[model samples]
Target: MANRSAQDIRRLNRFEVLRRFHASSGPRTRQDLASETALSFATVSNLTSELIGEGVLVEAGHAQSGGGRPRALLTLNAERGTLIGVDVGETSVRTELFDLALGKMAVDERPVTPEDVTPDQIADLIEAGAGAVLAAAESPRSRVLGAGISLPGLVERERGVSTYSPYWAWRDVPMRDRLAERLELPVHLDNPLKASALAEMWFGAGRDVDNLVVVMLRSGVGAGLALDGTLYRGATNSAGEWGHSCLVFEGRRCRCGNLGCVEAYVGTAGIAETLRALAPDDPLLAQADGAAASLLTGLAARAAESDPIALAVIRRTAAYLGAALGNLVNLLNPETLVLGDQVAAHLGERLLAETRAALAGHTLAQPLRAVTLRLSSLPHDAVSRGAAALAFEGFLNDREVFGPVSRTRGVKARAEGRG
Candidate 1:
């Protein structure tokens, strides 16, 4: 890794202070922040002062004191700015608007089919959704700090390109630049894996855990890794393409044109295929409604009603999911393995238990004992929320990347519905 410049270190330090402030339940004094972040009192004070001056933080009364004057308390200024998070899935584009506090203000989803997707088409969808949310919230574009968009498949993050999208068959699509031009806002692009991992780290199951693996089980499956408290992008920034890992030799073909990938057996299409194989004449399989999400929901409902075929399908899926998760546990030894996204949300604990049972057979006892597998507690909108978290981080880490909006202050004045 290259050495961090003095400016970079200052940015990180400022971000660390803000991170602690966001995570705190109430307010904090500079001394409390110093103790928590282990920064010197002077450093904490300086950072807090800068943030307060920029309207990123506000004084929140004062802390109790045994003697002398009470210390002033500080808290995040939710009205400081807004953020946009977009989840561009094979089936739809989900966009959400959030305040500086990461509270959701509005959300919108637009249907999209993988076969019909193009860089321009996806960008248009994202722009439309963002505009809808901002309009719903009655917020101006100038208040938007930045937008974080998560795409499926391999993403070249630094270059803002969708290097490869198995679902859409897209290669080297310059998505970030396209969105930036259309929205006229700073844009950050990454895949769902990284976005989901960031969401988990910030507000979901991995909040307290350093080593976490978030397995996104949708039409396009992948893992987002957080190792040692940071997102681990591999040398090529495609580290978490766990879905494409070979699971069976010469088995089912994957959307990525690979044979026997983990996603071929565990993703939404994989689960549907499993149902078809178990009962070729299954009514759900022959339904005119072609949405995989609807099919999975129906299957999950049947499983809940104790249908034998659905139960069996669930078991079979568990076996595949368990094997995939077990491999992850054995290799990464993550503290938590979170099952997230649409399909996982549909199956819930039934899949969790069965997968745990199946995972036992594949994982070594030592690693299995150390890992805890659970369904993600985040809402179905995890990807978009995570996308927003990404934008938030980018803004905090390097304010310049967010452009002029973030540079200006007086959020307190703007919060009163005035520009």
Candidate 2:
């Protein structure tokens, strides 16, 4: 047990070291890594030496110095291996291929019709899409380190089971096993809430902030929480199901069969419901059945033009979203609350301003003052990028299985000082 504990500690330290390199824009020196990761200088030296020997990291010359010898700089070897991140939404299955440094190499997306609801159907789509993305990148499957899959609805990470999917009425589907069997690689499963939060922590607005909240708006609404610089998954790993929390008593019916849930008023479907309620004859309503992405895009476009009915829908949705967000602010008191996903990106600052205004009315003076509300800086493919981050973490945990880079296999070892 003691040996195992020490091994776990070593692995975690290695992961932190590699994560710092991936997050950094340029090469990092040994001292820089020690300071950033809070590891001992000797420990950093040992880990970096091991990684350098494995070809996962390579020395990139030396840093400039005013006096004395310059420090050697280290950076990730992009040829180490590859990772894949897949986002399985209600309307689409998008896959992204990335190098060891998490730089995107290729992307492939396939539409998901309403009929494609079964686990096997979705898994097949994911497998095919990942293959297409790898082919686009001209990367062989043998070089792939692993894959991270982000799905909508509740997920059981340890068991790799999807506990529930509101759109498809799926219960306890073994998603991770299914994908691992088909892809023949290490697989990590998580909900979009967790994936989005990880993305923010690793690369977006939450990179510097310790406490943050990421609210994702799409076909459904959810919040991902990062408290004290760590994701709080709760006891059951279902902590971020904020969208299902009741917002109104006996109000609109939600797709989850719950009345007055926050999602019923703020999700893409809920926004469309509001539009239909206000103006049933609106042309955008015609596309709501299976083309929700188009409908929301149209709604945002109409709202941008200051169309009365569209603006009304926006205003009403903002009020609901703001109030719900206010509750989050008061309870969590996060340093930052980021609005993300396609819906938030489409509405942009117009919706942000109104939500902020509405949020002020509901939150306490002190907490509200400390919290900053903003849109996500990540691209529309934030979820998939985050999924790739998941794969990266998995690789760091069990790197021995993937072995060393093929390109550096037979190279002669250089001096330890340079590495």
Candidate 3:
């Protein structure tokens, strides 16, 4: 939670009004906002007028049937500006463009292998991707309010610095300045998992849920924490490093050279490693030749044919991840646990069933019963989309950058009905 102060109370109140209005099912009148936020109508009215003056919200129109004088409706003004998102994943850079309401307008992607990725190379990819997206969208470059980059490492967002990035081999780089210089736009940077969690809160499976945890399963395991609709990064911004959390006591070696980490047993790469370790003589491991996707596909194929070895591997993987899920449920007791990313793509019903059973067995009965577990219904591009939302949200908060245009003027202009 941000530190509240007498000086910033009004700012915070305006932000709250904007957030509530944005998440609402439709444009909300002052009366509606007051009811939803438990604030007085007078407070909501002043806040909405200020928001309209700032071009953040517009008095869209009156409700069709309010009986008497149709109450004015306020909606987020889509013309405020555009937001850009770049997802720097394990092996690719994806950039996306979005309107104020989180509607995707265009996207572009570039590939970069993890080992060879460098700061300059990654920056080049981001620039190119953003350029491609903007060109495709035919949006004027000046209209882009800002850009956001979601990396796969620890970040110091306050300084716009990436403390460390394992995927791109970067350390203590002034990433925000570099991107801003290249793109000539304001930028916000954060962890991809954080972006993903924000995406879930805004558009994906965790939508409408206040307390939620978004788990990304890829070569490793990680989590995104949302506390009361806010992304909760730990003191060091390493809050979701569940991949590095130890699960086994002196167990198998992890990629991070740790013993008994949960990720070593439950991640897609971890499952592949386990397959190779346990099935040295099996044809499946030989067929995959160490590709994570191929290995998972091979395991799924054999499991489909009722291969005991394959089924056992999957069952064990499920148990480990389920145990990890149990830990999350107990600790956070979130309203939802969302499984997403590439690893989730390979999970079959059998894996889910085993995971569900393990979760039920491991967690406290009450929380387990209350929590809903669901597979991610988001597209493979969720990371990029989430990053875009991060950019949009960052842009919205900095009110100094906005200029005031009175609520009455906005309503009068609307009466003229200009698109």
By TM-score, the best candidate is 2
Q: Please list the C-alpha lDDT of all candidates, in the order they appear.
A: 0.82, 0.85, 0.75
Candidate scoring better on lDDT of 1 and 3? 1
Q: Which residue segments of model 2 deviate by more than 4 Å? A: 1-13, 37-40, 400-419
In the order shown, the candidates' Cα RMSDs to the true structure are 6.2, 5.9, 6.4
Compute the lDDT for candidate 2.
0.85
The TM-score, computed over Cα atoms with residue i paired to residue i, of candidate 3 is 0.87
In the range 4-79, model 2's lDDT, one tens digit per residue, is: 3344455545656776776669999999987876677887898889889878899999999999989999999999
Predicted candidate 3 versus true structure: per-residue lDDT over 1-419, tens digit per residue: 13433324444445556656545568888878777655566766776777787777888888777487788888988888888989887767888998876678998888777555778778999999999999999998899988989987789887888887755557899989999999999898898788888777666655566688999888657899886655778887778888788888998787677898888888766787777777777766655533677777777778899998898898888888888888889989889888888777776567777788889878998889878888888887888877777676567555464422111001111111111
Give the count of colliding residue pairs in each prediction. Answer: 0, 0, 1
Q: Highest lDDT among the candidates is held by which one?
A: 2
Candidate 3 segments exceeding 4 Å error: 1-3, 6-26, 37-39, 281-291, 297-310, 348-350, 401-419
The candidates, ranked best first by TM-score, are 2, 1, 3
Q: What is the lDDT of residue 159 in candidate 1?
A: 85
In model 2, pairs of residues that clash are none
